[model samples]
Target: MTIVLHGIRNCDTMKKAFAWLDGQGLDWRLHDYKKEGIDRARLEGWVAKLGWEALLNRAGTTFRKLPDAEKAGLDAGKAVALMLAQPSMIKRPVAVAGEALLVGFDPARWSATLK
Candidate 1:
């Protein structure tokens, strides 16, 4: 399985996810969206599959710091644009394995999908 993990390396959650994948002996690719930048098409697809609420990282500083105007009354296109412009605004450790895409890390779910 080819798993692609997306997040900033410095994030604690992302660090834990990487460590877990390594311990499991899973081969995966890391996409540091902070440096490489997020693709609009990919973000759109993720949003569609995961829904805006799931994809949006409300816990992150980026999202919390957004202006009220920017945060309020978001639509799909606008949300995608925001995420693309601010990759940190998206949730951490979004993993894509084949046609399966998962946002966030839950051990139970990871075990089911990756084990």
Candidate 2:
């Protein structure tokens, strides 16, 4: 399986996710969103699959720093636009493999979904 992992390289969660994937012997491509920049189309696609609430990382500093107005009244389109503008606002370790896309890395979920 060809997997594309997306996140900032220095993020602790992302670091763990990458280490786990490596230990699992999976060959994957890392899409460092901070460096490569996220595309609108791809962000929209993730929003379609996971919903805006799931895709957006409200727990992250990036999201916390956003103005209150921007955080409220968000639909998929609005959320996608925000994510495109600030990739760090998206959840960590978004993995795309074939037609399956995953948001965040829970070990059990990763084992079941990716295995």
Off by over 4 Å in 1: none
True-vs-predicted CA distance for residue 50, candidate 1, Å: 1.5
Q: Estimate, for each residue in 1-114, the C-alpha lDDT of model 1 and write its tens digit.
A: 869999989998888899899999999989998788888888888887879888988888888889999988988887888888889988988999988888998767988988
User: lDDT tens digits, residues 91-111, model 2?
Assistant: 988999888888998988988
TM-score on alpha carbons, each prediction: 0.95, 0.94
Worst 10-residue lDDT window, candidate 1? 106-115
> What's the TM for model 1?
0.95
Report the Cα lDDT for residue 96, model 2. Answer: 90
lDDT of 1: 0.87
> By summed lDDT, which 10 consecutive residues of candidate 2 come out lowest?
41-50
